[model samples]
Target: MAQKTVLFKHLEQPEIHRLDVYRDAGGYGALRTAVNDLAPAEVTQMVKDSGLRGRGGAGFPTGMKWSFLPKEYDTSYLVCNADESEPGAFKDRELMERNPHQLIEGCLLAAYAIRARHAFIYVRGEYLAIKELLDAAIEQARQAGLVGERIFGKDWGCEVSVYRGAGAYICGEESAMLDSLEGFRGFPRLRPPFPAVRGLYGKPTVVNNVETLANVPHIVANGAEWFKSTGTEKSPGTKICSISGPVNRPGNYELEMGTPFRYLLEDCAGGMAGGKSLKAYIPGGASAPMLPGDCQDVGIDFESYPAAGSTMGSASFILFPEDCCIVFAQLRISEFFSHESCGKCTPCREGSRWLRQMVERIEEGGGREEDLPILLDVTDNMVGKCFCALGDFATSNIVASIRHFRHEYEQHIRERRCPFRPHPAAEPLLQIAGVA
Candidate 1:
């Protein structure tokens, strides 16, 4: 199957966002089944048996994560990480916009599984309209006795709240989102007293990505084995792969986990756009390392990516064409990491800025043969040194671009200008003159 539209199947329906249409199409059946029939422990076991991993960067087992909660908890939270702030990751925003009910139902089922009394969909503030849609859907679920007051006449009663964040990339981190949900500055908390033990409002919590939670309803409605039959054994369930940049059809496509990137680019994405040959592609989001054009057969799974020296972070694949400058692309990405840096850790705060400056210098024809080792050294200092993954993320494209396209950077330095762009950046050229 080229594109398996599980969550996206009903997106074409104009009114599918509405509860009535959603229910008519068998929506909330999972939540109903989960609440009325399965016990919380049973629901958790089913998820564990399904082998569903987080669709976000971490790829942790969803069921095992749910099982982390304290045995006896008075109150807990379930957070849906809808802050789709990664550069190439736009699947979550559309997933919430088009299929709000399914998301709501999934949240409800997750809440039931974890015994969370409250579930919050922490959305990106840029998505004002989608936030309204989720708010309305939550209200709809509430009115139907699906959200509150002994859901399905059982002892479990959970409600969902839509909390819009100010579009901080750091807030996409679970702990940072929890801090934001508690009305604090969006900074990640120190671990050990992890979220499952003391999370939102200082209670146990489970944070999952929009795509990860969206799959829960299907898993619960159909058995775990049914869900497992579709994707790879290691990475069970489908992934909503977001392919952007220079592709004919650069949009989200729900695909089997182990499908190769070649199929996605040639068939699903309608091949490269404007007759440009594929020079490279970042298999995951900007955080994932960019792969060479020749490595197109890389499978889109948790194991396949790491085996190929990259990752499936958010399953956001950003394609690059021959005409595109790898250094320039990495410069733009580094600048983003620098701009979005929360400054909580010195490594990321200083290293990201320095990394951006180095890449910018290389692109503007000020790079040295020695700058290569210096750039690598700087990234070496920053990796695994940040408060969160931001610093580590800042180095992915830079290191990968250097590794795969060292000749390109060398060409820029040797020719004293970017090969792709004939006209050179003038400011750096002017700096040599000292003619202020």
Candidate 2:
């Protein structure tokens, strides 16, 4: 967060997020260069050399994902997973809303690289303004002949359309986004056909997160070596991290990969609010396991997080100051996953309801001491038993809190009340059976 490096480079520019300013800064030149000069295969190889991975929750390599598409497929597509519904994660929304043309240019380059004829920008329904912004940008690109038929006046042409999601968290999942974009109920499909081989209308598709695609224009424009110079050897370039919760400066801060977590919190975020001591931090979005306050010194990158027993998901760093209860935080997180369960499998659908109910009972002063083991049991049953990641997504919060702060849950049960009351809005909610 210190110094606000990569992803935020344009945020401070006067109208820098606008297309005109972006072009002046050498924006869509990447697309023109790629389409005009480089072969699609060569472009993909450049991305591979740059070591760009998915900025989405999953940290899959971008070029590797694109390579998964079989060569024979005629109509491949790219769906920008702009459905930034992960709780405490809003980086993608910022990218699409502010630097939309960058994403469009990246999309065009990616479509050309993957030989995708048509692409779709699946914007989150809640971001109607961003949806409008991107739509206008796409139109502008079309008018300028940067998109649509005969892009740059060559035989190869690709067009893109913006598809609005109906505000479902499950749609953020790549396969589910395909289902939703195709006008289905947004349930996750089984993997194996994976989406590279079978996706969006039953053809090959390359789904990249908005931030991931945003980097493509930069990568294509500046060469792979230039992109490689910014961050760690394995994880190059900067990450847009959003710091909230009791921070003096609670906003998105872009920093080079592998930056220390301490620097991100204490330096970039201007330290905690009111000079309070840090308690715990959710390194990734809510779905990732929480990290104890002792682990705050770990580096913020793809490699360091798993070693620290967390993920660098979407580079979201939600800080919790001291005096905040982990039980309260865990309950809030559990409720989100439980509510967002796509109901594709019983383990998540039923297990999330039970977890929420058990946590609520403990929080509300009515739970038994024996319920602690039962909560673990519920999560244990659901962890790998569900259809999609949604089930594991629901269980991670419970397991993480219990693993790190079982004593906190016991304290709530023994005291029969929450210990800290910072905000009236923080009033704990009791679980109603069958509500989840």
RMSD of each: 4.7, 3.1
Model 2: runs farther than 4 Å from truth?
A: 1-4, 421-436
The Cα error of candidate 1 at residue 203, in Å, is 1.0
Pairs with steric clashes in candidate 2: 1-268, 2-268
lDDT of 2 by residue, 132-171 (tens): 8888888887888888889889988888898999988899
Compute the lDDT of residue 96 as modeled in candidate 2: 78
TM-score of each: 0.95, 0.95
Give the range of the ten consecutive residues with the poorest summed lDDT in model 2: 427-436
lDDT of model number 1:
0.86
Against the correct fold, how does model 1 do in TM-score?
0.95
Q: Which one is best on lDDT?
A: 1
* Candidate 1 residue runs with Cα over 4 Å from true position: 422-436
Pairs in steric clash, model 1: none
Clashes of 1: 0
Per-candidate local distance difference test: 0.86, 0.82
